[model samples]
Target chain A: MAEPRPAILIVEDEPEIRRFLRTAFGVEGYRVVESATGRRGSIDAGTHKPDLAIVDLALPDVDGIEVIRRIREWSPMPIIVLSARVQERSKIEALDAGANDYVTKPFGIGELLARVRAALRHAVRSPSGTSILRFGNTVVDLEKRTALRDEEEIRLTPIEFRLLAMLAKQLGMVVTHRHLLTVVWGPTHEKDTHYLRIYMKQLRDKLEIDPVRPRHLLTETGVGYRLVLDE
Target chain B: MVSIDKQRKPPAHPFSKIPAIFMGNLQRSWATVLRMNLKRHWVGYAWAVGAAAACTFVGLVMYPRFDLVNVAMVYLLAVVIIALRFSRGPAIAASVLFVAAFDFVFVPPRGTFTVDDIQYLLTFAIMLSVGLIISRLVKSVRRQAAAQAALEIEAETERIRSTLLASISHDLRTPLAVMAGASSSLAESGERLSAAERHALAKSVFDQAQEMSEHVAKVLQMTRLETGAIKVDRDWASLSEIVGAVLARLGERMAAHRVIVELPDDLPLVRVDATLIEQALGNLLENAAKHTPPATVVRVCAQRRGEEVIVTVQDYSAGLSDRDLERVFAKFHRGSVEGAGAGMGLGLAICRAIVRLHGGQTWAERVPGGGTAFRFTLPLEEAPSAPLELASN
Candidate 1:
């Protein structure tokens, strides 16, 4: 039997952007639900029950963050934010407000499609996330709290293990500094961003082939860190 | 005073920053003038009265030993000193005060407001005229300085406007023209072209659009940096992470160059706006890749020296000439080699601005082995103490 096509809800004010997005998503064999305003977007989110939502941060009717909040209130659907380069602060705000991923404006459709696919795949995966995260030759089993490279076992500090597990929970998506710090080091250490910098380097040095130019443990610049795992 | 003709003929591109240099001097002079005048406005009158009283005491003592003319000359000296040291108001007040005191205390009539000698009347006129003339000269000099500053700012604004217009027409118009032509052809006669030709046309449209978007972004970013609109959101950040992010962002752009990153494992974290630093580093790398030949090595390295971390991006290409090295960081300065790359020549300028905002310095030098090295220094701070954790391995 053919599987039901996944639906994608796009909340954007510009009809031209919507038209291109609709065409791109349509050509990719996904059902697209369009909303011209934030109010209608929140309404469509409940009615359509899409597998993913692409929300433009700057909307005409209401703030896009409000739409993300509204959808997150009732649904666990993956939401990808479309932000302009100028909206750096608000982009991070949207991501922290439960957005799964983001693609900056003037971005090619292929970038957006990859983010959408990652967010959608992340949605259908296990709630506890993949226990075994693999990148390059390094394999980390979060459930067992063991890291191995090739056939050799690698020692990971307790904080390193916890940081890996926190990043693993949001696999393939950006985990904000505040989120990672809060989860791994507790709420009191949320603002201690130096801890994240220190630990992320250690993690990268241990797992990445070239720690300076990491291929999997990615830094999203000002936003946070993203851990990409091999399928 | 500034002439209207200078406004019509804006300075050339080479001297574009002359106005900024002029503005620095203007600001410093204004600051010094303001600091001197801050407490001198209302207090100058008191100083005028005080000087007159002090001269009156000297005149009273001199009247008993010398001729009354010597006492009159002493009052005249007070007026000359006041005129030299103060504004017109204080100078005029000092002149009138000295004249009244001389007439009351020393002129034939002792301790009364009367002038018994007409020659002393000439002395009063001379004192008043000196005060007015000196103050007028001082005021003119100040006004001239102010007018000169305003003229420089106006000429600079005109220069920037023209340069911006010229850059827009040259950099943005090319890609826009290609995009318009290609898209129209695809729309008007898609079925007439072969599959590969159609794909190539569409791909060119996409590529041109992307290129134009980058140009527009650089223009906007330069504008924002110039206007002081971008605020640095600083936090503790790792330089390696920043470099990693830049390399990733410039993946395809740097693919032609053999990129090498040499950061130490124990490199301390820097407090900076990581996003801006990433852009700054990315621009430098992109510039190196754009100017250097393919397969040449481009190295990115950072070393801690004293309290600063010096980051260098070295490209093994033909080095810039001495003059080119000096002007490479200027806006709209393209590489000397033609057809090497196409950019609005704002990458290094923007990189300099971003680095400067973080209290860092950026410069380019000729590498020893026929290449250029673009280096910047970022000041380092003591790393924040992290919470101690057990290994529990």
Candidate 2:
């Protein structure tokens, strides 16, 4: 067990929230570096060079989006945002500003932990990610342009494959509608969310066991879509 | 000494009573302004003139067939009716106009303002007095009715305030008590308790905190909906997607009941704020889960009816009374069985408000086989054009 432990940087203004996060991350066998303001958070990101960073959007000195931008300028470290339920617009904005993921305020520590683990694992994986994705009995191979459900090949339109590939690229993290639409349907259709809705339903119908309560391809309500795969 | 103090209290110096003098003058000015406002009803004056003309015409016709005293009686009736219908200004105007017209047309002078009989002066005086007295009486009654209406509004405000306070103290205080007791126990006696016991206490604290947060969020959301702070960001969305998201959000809360969904495959895409619609549907599911007993079946169904889509959440429980069915959507209206963990009864109210903001209607009705159905409609819109992949591929 000579592997160096992963480090996490927490940028939050409230001392109470920071205290709990410290304890939670500590108990989970991760080293934590705390910053009380966004300015200090950006500085610490450059100094500590942590494997990942969890930043609160409501910072005292600067906007959390600013911190993410500064970090993006120099590092490709996984950045996850902590936002309140009221900050729905900024949550999407943070994602569009290069944030890898977000956890809403008043969230269970388990939910945050799962997100953190996924983001870190995604960072460690190949930059192109895995070509083959699996959801329950369904398997989709992006490179091969194939989808199978229970070993039977299911036909998917080219747009559906492209949408799946875009979601799979940010697998386990929220991919904003703007990001997916821009990448899959070109920049002209960035604001056309119905395309995503129609295609997502099509994908879910063909792949999911029960399309109504999907286990893998999930909708993020006003935010975006997240593609989760069984390990 | 007491007499001297009383004398001092009466303000020995004139300067000491300056504020009192000023207040009296201010009150008089306000009364004048109110009187000016009362006289601003020109329509009433017009009606008064019309009434006087009609009485004059009738009086002239009766000058040959009836007595002059009877014509004066007609003038008195016109004054009384005008006083009852309008303010003092119109009443006085009606009486004065009638007197001049009667003297000029029906009196000794056939077309002049000269009166030959002294008793005609008596008739004019009586008409003026009657007009003034009736207008004063009518004005006082109107003032009383306006005061009563204002008092009713104040009482309503007081009722809502008390209800809000009661709800906050009951719903929010319970969670506060649990969190305080549980956390204090863990802080003071963590070493003495077993691992499972400590875990249970911690979990209760967490669950209570979550419940408290939800209650607070609902209160805030209701206020935001009422204050016009919520902007409905409409987009092309599917009812099936919104329904699925709500079920997943209410995962464990609805787990106790046997939930069934019946949505048609060809359901059209609706243009609405998806997140708000999700919350609206979630509240219905939560209400159904809260009222019904465990293991009862709850059905979520949707159908396209004409230009709108009707979504229903039906629960197979003891149906609500006719009164409760209507009152359920009113703010702070609770059901008969308010078990522990019951909300402040704002879920349905919030649901109704959100649905209305989306140009939809919500209602509750009893199902035939002994259950309640909560239904709402979302107006449909023309579907957007889907992208073609042929040329791009």
Candidate 3:
């Protein structure tokens, strides 16, 4: 296994949002590097080699989507774009530009961190073989396709299973609400991300240390949900 | 180079302008007519000889019966008439002839060729001077009026353009705001709603709003193109992703009508504005839907030609005329009277500008089998290979 602490890159230009993110990541016992512009943010992404990059689409010189594309050119590092622009076109462009995920602005801090952690975790999982996937007392088996909570097998409906598979595929990466809805349901179901809450509630009630304050099945709120593992 | 040295101007009195210059113009036209001929030709001897003969005859008959003052006045009238009607050469001849005749018959020495007094010489010169001044003033006024008329014409054209822009700018803004506002609100509405109600409402709001928005955008595009505002943002992008995104966003509308897409399995990447290109294609699709009947086949096909790709949207509906094809992309122009009440009427105009902004072309034509076909080109970029190609093979 790797070290306990992970370093993160906060590529947002907004001061308040950056401070909030830095504090959140710092509390989580991770090193946080902050960048204001897309160009500077991208360089920091490379040199610092942080576990994750949280980029905003609107920058003074370069667009965030372009920043994501450039970083994606060399590394398969996880990039989650933060844009105040809610245009569907920008979302697809960011995702297709090699960004791992996207979140619109006026977003919850929990969602941003959730996505940042999710993206980094997913990147780490993609290159290496599967390790024991645990969220609180719950454990998941990727190869055998199984799950257990507190030493008891957990039964999940097909929709719930697919949703878990998609999220687990990313591991800790922040999957877009649009992306998750589409994958769990279909392209036509992309707009119906509310379904995420119901299924997420089901997983949390059955699998988390505290269903009310779930440690593993975290709600990113407005972004999507994130699954964090605790030993 | 003229001097009114008692020899070349009209009489100073305003009354003299009409009698001595204007109405007198008909009788005095001979002098002006002769002067024009002289200025144009090398020899003007015939004109001079002609005026002298006419003056001499009048001087002869009148000189015998009248006294010196009476005959002198009559001869003086002949000199002014000759000066006004003929060249200066002829005028001087008539002046000399009259002076000689006045001295011979009407002076103290009657029938004798002698000028007893020289005061009469001043009279002839002053009369000639007045005639020349009148003719020159008329010509200058004509030139000034012609120049003023030209300035007025140019000013009128500028006024029209500004007026048209003001009305059109206001006209295009309102409906665009309504449509764009509606789409965002509908898309962000309540979630507990049933699928059918949600789908129908979302589709209706989005599709109709999009139609209006596209129309408004096209109208805005037309103005931007005219004002030279469309700038390109060139970058590399996956074609399939742009198409997928457009289709998904436009899905709320295209879903009702069966949208058939055929993109190449091995399509190359393209360099364009992912948003603007999608908007352009979106406008074309909207154009087809608005014009074509519902539940009809609307096919969006992407075909490759070497380093370029042609995206075609064909609708099985009544086709456009040759006249429509010629002016279809023009601002405020319609494909037919069919979709006359359609949004802002700028769909094709915007498409043309967006396509051009990408350094490509867009055009529409009648499909051979029937209906209308809209096509635009995208310069394709060759990627190493698609990830899909590797997986599928």
Candidate 4:
């Protein structure tokens, strides 16, 4: 008997984005169903019973958070939201309405995949979800506060790991400047997005090739940051 | 200063101002003036006939006591009435009639149409000339006084509006800015909580505060815009740099839409007030966000066309109708029914005033597909005023 492949449903308004998510998730060996509007997207979630859903917070007729809430009335699947408004309010609403994490637009393929994986892990764990994640030659064990790169232990400060875990939990999605700052450096650090400029360089140097042009850590200029998990 | 009131200035013609402004217990129009003149003609003609009959009766009776004093008084009354009621053409005719009456009944030959005394002839000519001068003076002074009063009223009203706006500025903006800053800080502090708790706290504080801030900005901008007293220091600045500054300043707003910058890197510099242009662009971008759907692309681009650098901000939202495109730049003329209510419409109006101050132009048009494009221009770089020395020097 074969193991069931965790299905990821993508809800987006643009054809380019829907196609992008469908192809990306399909390549990763997860069954992917794409819907172009919030209503159909929410319906697909209920009917398909996807293990995880990637939702765009901006839709033509409805806000993605409302869709997340309606589905959450019944299903407990983890939802990862994509948004252009990197403002904190929208992100919080999507999550509180049952989305597992949030991503800002113009994201990398790998960052989205990682978020999908992390969200699935979160769905499996339910509330108070925390987990271990591995990508490329690195391993992150959030429960133990440790990380290893290629079997060699890589040191991560409590704050650095908190930032890493923040990205890890929203893997395959964009983690906005305010969100990362709020999670690691506290609210005072929200507008201090320049702080991310300094810390992100640290994360890439520790985990990527040619840290100057990082693959796993990407910047969505004027939006936020995305963590791509593909090697 | 722009008056907060909407009263328009009456036209330059004094006749136009007379109806509304006349210490006017009278609703006077040109037609009314004409009607009154026609109505007075019947009484005037009867009085003239009566006076002619009275002079002939005294002459025919040969009353020696009826001297020049009695004849002069009767003729003078006719001159005054014609000058006041009828026009210049009619007044001259009345003067002629006065001279005939004196010559026939009191000049010399009693009841005869002949001037018997040379002394009486000079007296009659002198009275006619004086009557003409008096009529002309009355006409000129009335028109001049009407115009002078209208100008005084406009100036006085402007002074009052400026004083009121100045006082409102200090009272309104200071408190609004303080509340906005404090609310944002509260929202940002939602960190260090469990995932659910953190999200909840951030949503409430950030959203309510944002709404209040948008409203405050519109009121402040309007009050400031109305003054026409923005002190903008202009110099040679690059369009690319201006766009970058505008985008950077609208950090919060740009977060909601995909803003694509398509300005060429090598575009020429333009003489402009960098701060004001940035502020204007900030308003335009904010306007776009309010109208355009979330995630629809908003673009800012610039190019040198015919010695002018054209800068345009285009949004892929519902385009405006013909009426909206026409008055989009008008003061406080907001897109009321077409879009969701946000801030008061002062954005494009500010943009227009800014561009015109630069001695350039601004306009808007509906894009073919489904969006509104706001386009404006700045003059291309002029030869540097400083004496240019060769680099070899």
CA-based DockQ, model 1: 0.69
- Order of models, best TM-score first: 1, 2, 3, 4
TM-score of chain A of 3: 0.62
Q: Residues B263-365, candidate 2, lDDT per residue (tens digit)? A: 9998989999998999999999999999889999999999999999999999987899988999999999988777786789899999999999999999999
lDDT of 4 at B248: 54
TM-score for each candidate, following the candidate numbering: 0.88, 0.87, 0.40, 0.39
Candidate 4 lDDT by residue in tens digits, A122-205:
566555434576657888788897789988898766666777778766665556666787877787756554456545655666
Docking quality (DockQ) for each candidate: 0.69, 0.52, 0.03, 0.01
User: Where does the lowest 10-residue lDDT sum fall in candidate 2 chain B?
Assistant: B1-10
DockQ-best of 3 and 4: 3
Query: Which residue pairs show collisions in model 2?
Result: none
Report lDDT (CA) for all predictions.
Answer: 0.87, 0.90, 0.66, 0.68
The TM-score between candidate 2 and the true structure equals 0.87
Is candidate 1 or 3 superior in DockQ? 1
Which regions of candidate 2 fall more than 4 Å away from where they truly are? Answer: A1-4, A39-50, A60-76, B1-40, B106-110, B114-129, B390-393
What's the TM-score of chain B for every model shown?
Answer: 0.81, 0.85, 0.48, 0.54
Off by over 4 Å in 4: A1-231, B1-226, B336-338, B383-393
Per-residue alpha-carbon lDDT of candidate 3 for residues B1-393, written as tens digits (9 for 90 to 100) = 122422576456665445435555786689987677566642434544554565556756766675556655665566556555544555555556555655555565567765556775565455445434433444466668888998898797677566546645555555556556655655676465577766666555544544444444455566676688656655444454455546654655676576777776556557676667777787778777777767998988888887788989889877888898777776556556844445544667777888887777777789888988888888776543322212432
lDDT of 1 at B252: 82
Model 2 CA lDDT for position A72:
95
